[model samples]
Target chain A: MLVIEDLHVKVGDREVLKGLNLEIKSGETFILFGPNGSGKTSLLMTLMGFSGYKVVKGKIIFKGKDITNLPVYERARMGIGMSFQRPPTIHGLKTRDLVQMCAKYAQNKEIDVLNLAKKVNFLDFLDRDINSGFSGGEIKRSELLQLMAQQPDLLLFDEPESGVDLENMALIGKIVKNLLRGNGESPRPDVPMKELKKIRQVSGLIITHTGYILDYVNADRGQVLMNGQLCCEGRPRDILEHISKFGYKECVRCLNK
Target chain B: MSEQIKIDRFKLEGMEVEQDLQQFVSKYKEELEMAGIVVNELERSGTYLHLNQNPLQCKSHQSGLEILDIKDALSKYDGLPDYYWKAVDKNKDEYTKLAASKVHGGYFIRVSKNVKIKDPVQSCLFIKDENVGQSVHNIVVVEEGAEVHIITGCATSHKVKSALHLGISEFFLKKGAKLTFTMVHNWGEQVEVRPRTVGILEQDAVFQSNYILLKPVKIVQSFPVVYLNGSGAVARFNSILVATPGSYINSGNKIVLNAPNTRGEIISRAITTGGEIIAPGVIEANNVPAKGHLECKGLILNDGVIHAIPELKGTRSGVELSHEAAVGKIAQEEIEYLMARGLDEDEATSTIVRGFMNVDIMGLPLKLKQAIDKIIAETEKDMF
Candidate 1:
């Protein structure tokens, strides 16, 4: 549901992404593997239309509309959502209030915020200040809770497994898979699996340094990003195996080839 | 810099008083409601209404609570031998001197020992005559092992402008007593306000003070101080201030911890759209094992100024004191974070400002809290 062509982004006098091209269709999940400072977050930020990540030469098409220069709120309203890695803490703004705000544009106007928060185990933090003194895993769950309320057509995740423990990782992985599959923990018991998968259409673009998320999500395709360029493409499991065996240094050979 | 108010421009006396409570409530209902006074409806333990230079109405519905005019209380108790002008000095400033020279009218509320008053005592100091100068001296005393709450509202009539209000308030809390005092100010655009206040707490006494100012005024300057004199006593101060165009507010709070095991905290939030605000706070700890903290924050929306000054002092080696102060505009990161949730810039900004001015921490009554929320919402509309 999103397309980028020859995207070149600059962040404060330094070019971070160069000649990047990618496309994801409806009902598809794309996994991006990258090293440090390899422009993974830059791509997600540019896609979401954040300020300070200037698009020097590029065009973005989302759902058949050019949104390269749209404001952040307009893009969000047009069904593009992002989960930040380190979100800012807003004092006196309760988590419940934010979730309600996110649900403002949803098709389902009446959303049960407390019930949605229960799925992510964030009921205790509903009345607390958003993202204040939250642990790493708690931040992830809070983000997921907000995304559930948003129900956007496209989701951009930035390292969902960065600071999660083993137990929390399993819970987060299952939720992420459900979000991408468009079922959200509720599947019809009468419909066949194939039929159910055909009725739901949601797209995801996930960035990960570690392939620990492969065990949960059915990622359709995977690609490697190194030095501001996409170098390799293959099955997510196969790409993980190749990188684990030889490290990201072997990606340069693929780039040269 | 702020505009100067000439004391000679206002009249000190000769204003008529409306002796009927129903007539007074019907005349200035909106203004009184804005100042958190619900006349003839709310279940208040006592009610006191003071017009310029006159005590129009004073009565107490609940037993064990006495509400009288300050002048009557003075003569009744032989100048209130233990309470009148005990905590606050009469010669501290020009406003205090004016209030001392001619005590127009104020409330004198006292709760009997070991009696817990359920409903709050409501009082209103109103000015309805043009160019009238009103001076008042208020005193509240909570006896030993007693509990009470007082809501004091000060306002000027809609048609009355160019008035000066000078107020002097003193509070005394005995051993193991609890007192919660809330004051709301809703003055006219040309009115100038000056209030001097001080409070003293005994052993195991708890005192909480909440002050709110949402309406526009020419100038407002006050710095209230409280002292913890006995061990295990606690004190807290919370203030929310907003200044519109042509308004100038200079206010703060100070707490002095004198006994061991005493604690104090001061927190203030201010916003200036096109006016000026100077917020200063201080806390001093003199005994060992005492602790105090002060926090002052301000936000400037348009072409205005906000100055925050926080100070802390410790006299002994084991005393702990700290302070934090910040004055600036809203951070862009906070705005963008909210924008990413699908709200436009204006909506997101107003939301953030609403949170910044949240009064939930004040623990006010539900009706008063709702009234203040409505006022904040109306004020936000003018900011944009």
Candidate 2:
């Protein structure tokens, strides 16, 4: 569903991602494990087409169309959605309004907003400003709530379980699982079950630091990104176990040989 | 036999142009409608097209809101009400004197004791004749333990170039009473407006004032004051203004805490595309155990200038007062954040601008709040 070929990225005169290549098939969930200062975020941002993340030399193909030069909003409309690791607090923009905007892009635009908010335990925060004064767990849930509302064909999650606590992690895990499986709740009762299932089962590229999300979604494969390079393609669990026992340096060392 | 008197003694230091009244009305019907005023009630002079046209067009009787023409109210009581000219002096400025000497048309609203008026009393002061000043004096009295909301819109037609509007508003809130007043203005590019307003809050009374000026005008100067005279009284002032190119706006507000345990807050948000804006405010804490906060923020959308001068004065030792002021462009990060959510660049910029203008209109009725939101949305469409 998504392809990245020799994607080179720069941030303020410094090349962050140097000739990185990755691909994920339709309905597949791919995991990316990288240490701090790696080019994981750079790849996600470049894919989303944020300004200043200059694509030095690369092309991102999604759904058989090249989108390396599209604006952020055009990319979003083309069924590409992302969850920021640290979403900024927006003053005077209600969380409910943002969620409604997301719903405008979803295939199932008639989702129950109140119920969706309740799924992330954010029923009372619907009227509050977006991410303003929110706890780390609340921020993650808010991002996930928007992503679920959008229901994009290709989802990009940056550090989904980074700052979330254990209690919220369970709920986040359950919701993320539902989102991937195409079973998100909808207010419309007229949609057929088959179509709903087809609409919900979306492909995603997830970035993780500690592999805590591995307990939730089934990953088809995982890759380690180090020093602006992708190496060591293997089972997500096995790669996570290796990195937990031995640091990223050991993984890089073993992969190079 | 009574004689019809025409007062023209007050004049500003500027020239006024001539315009056709009928053409002016036809050109500004949309603006008058946007302010939620009935088209039939609009008139060139102090006369209603329909005698039975209610000022509160939407369910006024059910909410127990009494709306009366200022002339009729004055005639019925044999004179102006006691609260008239009580908050704001009649001889404060040339504009106030102009309003008092020849008050063409205004509204008198009174909420009885312990009654809550759900619907806002809507009034519109529209100018259809050029070179003619529309001077009005309004008075509102909310009795003890009562609550009410008042919305007033003022505008002039684009055809009516170089007109003047002098408005004087006085409000009196008795003990334990609350009043929320919202005023919206949309003037032509060659009009000048000077409004003089003041409010007095009794013990435990609450007062809120919201002002929005979205359209361009030749010049506008206003400084509304509030006096927290009784213990535990509270006052809040919120304003949102946009200055188009070649327009000049000087808006300020003042609040005085005369009793202990009083609270006051002043917030002003201004956006200048190519005009000049001077936003100045002051808060005075005269008694012990008083608290006040002031915030002034301005956004320069183009090569315009904005001066935000907020002053805080505390005369007593037990009083706390602070102020924060800033003038700059809209944050690029906010724009990008919204753009990532599927809004285009223009949509994103306009969304952030709209958010900046929604400056915490607290304690407004739901209907009034919705109306204000609609006005903001419509005005922003013309702005960007």
TM-score of each: 0.97, 0.85
What is candidate 1's fraction of native contacts? 0.71
What's model 1's lDDT at A79? Answer: 87
- Stretches off by above 4 angstroms in model 1 are A183-189, A192-195, B2-4
DockQ of 2: 0.49
Q: What is the interface RMSD of candidate 1, in Å?
A: 0.8
Highest-lDDT candidate:
1
Clashes (N, CA, C under 3 Å) per candidate: 0, 2
| TM-score, model 1 to reference | 0.97
- Please give, for residues A1-257, the per-residue lDDT of candidate 2 as tens digits: 89999999999999999998888988789999988888899888888898889998989999999998988988888888888877777667889988888777678788788988888899999989898999888998898889878888888889889889888888988888777776554435898866665655588889998888999888889999898999989999998998898879775795578
TM-score of candidate 2 chain A against the true chain A: 0.92
Q: Write the per-residue lDDT of candidate 2 for residues B1-384, one digit (tens) a residue.
A: 111122353232232333344553465667665554444542211111111111222224534456677677788877765767878988886667766777665677778899986655666777655655666667888899998767677876556776777778888999999998888887878787888999999999999998888888878889999999999999999998888888899998999999999999999999898888999999999997999999999999867889999999999898999999999987766776766778788888887787787745555545445656777776677565
What shift in Å separates residue B83 of candidate 2 from its native position after superposition?
4.1
Give each prediction's DockQ, rounded to 2 decimals.
0.80, 0.49
Q: After superposition, how far is residue A9 of candidate 1 from its true place, in Å?
A: 0.8
